[model samples]
Target: MGTDISRPEHPPLARRHAWSLAAYRHMLRKRLTGQPAADLKSIADKRWDIAPGEITVSPPAIYLPGQMERVTGWEGQRFYPYVHPGPTMAGGLSIEQGPTRGYLIKNVWLIDGALYKGNASHWLTLKPQRFAPVLVENEIERGAIYCTQNGNSWFGTWLMEDCVTYALACDEGVPVTSAPSARYPLFTQAPPYEDWLGMNPLRLRTAFFHQLVLFDDVSHNRSRHQRYRAMGDKLLTHVEHAPHPGVFILRGHEGDLRLLRNELEVAEHMCVKWGFRVINPLRLDVPTIIAACAGARVVMGVEGSQLVHGVNVLQPGGTVFTLQPPNRFISYYKYMTDRDGQHFAFVVGTPDGDGFTIDINEVERTMDLLPKH
Candidate 1:
């Protein structure tokens, strides 16, 4: 969006193929259902149990920069059994922002000096920061771990901002049930709105170190990234096969859909000309993908959720090229990669209907300036 001289100028496409496909889907849905499903119908069938006082455990409090007494009243004490609620919905239980992090307890969210509490069923009063044993449940062993399921959503938000809280919970040394002996249940039974890597929370649980750690967008802090990187390095051992030194060009989505116009073609061109390895991250298992990212010197891809991998895996000072959609201006990855000590650059492209096209000449120019692999 800014007048950056390095930005690409792409020629507009003659046919809006992506737009046509979207329109067709809309029309077909309207014909079949008379209206589009709004308000999280996707998770209608999937249900979660929020059994309070299941097992009381006293986990240590996670402190932030500006908090006086540890913010502990309603938080550290209780462990939710299977608390899986999708993002805020009208009239539904909208999660309040906690002072320290995202949703941890119902109705109560911690800030700085004071704690904010909401209603009865969805409400509870704030108490003076105190420590007491509370119920906790590891959602992974129960059924599946809840996570945002969208490829085009903010990568750093999903991983660094949200998922880090889950990691924090595990680090508290709360007792958790073992992994399922049979087939693992999908995190959510619903079909994914966007492509995502199928990950088992069991692996994440194993990767966790039982230490009290508070995280707020760890990807933004170099020191925090080091800790996060340690976890990723541990997870890398699970990958049976991985390249030692590589440059990964992440392909967004899997199978048919793509986030950017001509992304596959662009990835192929880069691989042929610059010896970059094109990877569809969703195609590989979680551990393999993590290993590829951890070992890579450079990660290139259209701005999307897949870049979250860069936060956990890329070495400090690694380089990332975030090809942004020209019509849609987003700064999430730019700030995240920068905070993680990664040299970040953006190349804005021309929008072609729903997706956008990147200029090959601009890509080549940027590649020439980057350190040779």
Candidate 2:
């Protein structure tokens, strides 16, 4: 939601600054309005930065008591807390705590999945708003903290200072987009920093690397499924035997899994008819999944995370038929194609009398427009 502020008709420099400040304050006010009173105060205080070598001994020293509740809610499900014991100093420094009270905070971040395990790409793509702050008090007091209980984990932290600062810089801006992409990968081997200490660290320093494919709009979820099926059928019609190239269908649990399964079945039937191979890479690790899609000529899937993978692995000029959701929230796909110069088709679907159906003709029409690989 957008915030509104009054501005002078002919603004002077001071007046413009005043307006900007007002808008910024208004945004923060809106953000904190619904927060618990104590949480709000802590957020106000710790929201600022702390420099290196600062040590926080007490819980309040790091996290304001009430701020924890404000940062997390029902969806997070659990909160995990960890301390960076000074000896090895292995754990990432906590941004929540510091020596100075009013300094602007920087560099504190979160990631999902095992702290140092592979297969953690999901943690890389998440935006900053998704990160909740770690509540050390709860962890110390309760013994075990659950994210759903109102707290943040290492996985939910955002390390990208620029994104965090930009988000916070925009008074009252949504912080989700500003979160560091979950694509950052941590090193498995102990690096120079850990090595210099002569300590056998559990994991190496984390590195921010990896391209992200975010899909925003799903206006044609149902229809895209139909079009995917129809395209499989048409491709089948042309081939006397199964085509040399295979088809991979990817989907997630969110949307109509039944319809997705049906579409997969159609693709299989068409494959049988034309002799093309059909592959269902069900919840495979990111690398293997991408590798599989990279080799395929066509990749089809419902608009979800798997579609993101399709964008990553599908051969350039390779066809991607993305089914969109009924309601469009954000348009990550447009950004992907436009920014990266990727070859793809976006099919906006219409609701059918029965349920939802892709415009087969439109699907063909769009397919015809695809640049040949």
Candidate 3:
């Protein structure tokens, strides 16, 4: 249930130049027709005035594509296309929406990072693009950071994997700035990004960092989850009388193939009668959500990004029952949970007209089918 994740390698200078030329032609063509061309600069690698060691990389314009049948097979189920192509013009200017064509960014300062949202694009698209050596904005004045609003729903992207980027930048001895942007509040509830990495926020982002590092998605690494779980445990110490340890039934609120048409009502009734805590994650913050799921042995929900929180909190060897919506059976979560040693299972509901509905008996069967701990 896994597909190869192709990592972008730095191409030869000649080939890079060719790519640049091709990109320029493409942009020119789009421009003649009055299309947005924001990614034209991102096609070629550019060098700054900083020394080689001071600014260590010339990265390509990273383009992570939307879900494909060739990769996930679930693309056939989606009602709309994964990512829309062409120039993304908002207010007569090109906007960066990676995975789609014409999205390119170069000379991105590490200090004040940008946020790309929706589904798994934040980590899959934006984060990996930051895998270069450059001056971070955190080492400069309070207002020096450049911020941009790109997409919708940052969701859970500001977790451990995001913090590790700064940690890696600091290790590389890269000059970082100390500027704080207003966008920081929207990114995380915490004051300093460095605290998550177990470092002093001021010292880490303000000084030279000598190390560089990279990471895949969160569930691919257990130690990362362990670190997150420890952080969750520490946070839970402050909550007086948190929910008792048990199974959790995650009720999803948003989606085309959502748990609707009395399916959720039936599911909720059964879940409550069966000793499960029904949680609508949309109402909770990241820590509180993690704290709730960390204590549970089984987590069940309709498959979506919010279910990602389940993998984050559910312990190793936990059970995740994903409710698939007819043809839209994507395996992103299954791939993750399986890698993390969690028992992953799913039940495709009966297609009820355009959407679908799950019989509570299916839930009962899934519950019984779970491996006993």
RMSD after CA superposition, every candidate? 21.1, 22.9, 15.3
lDDT, residue 335, model 1: 43
lDDT of 2 by residue, 203-242 (tens): 1112111111111111223222233233223333322332
lDDT digits (tens) for residues 51-106 of candidate 3: 11111111111111221221222532221113221111011222221121112222
- In candidate 2 the C-alpha lDDT for residue 27 amounts to 31
Kindly indicate the candidate among 1 and 2 with the higher TM-score.
1
Output the lDDT of residue 194, model 2: 21
Instruction: State residue 2's C-alpha deviation in candidate 2, in Å.
Output: 42
After superposition, candidate 1 runs with Cα above 4 Å error: 1-156, 171-219, 239-258, 371-373
Over the full model, what C-alpha lDDT does candidate 1 score relative to the true structure? Answer: 0.40
Off by over 4 Å in 2: 1-246, 252-262, 269-277, 283-288, 325-330, 352-355, 359-361
Question: For residue 116, what is the lDDT in candidate 2?
Answer: 12
TM-score of 1: 0.48
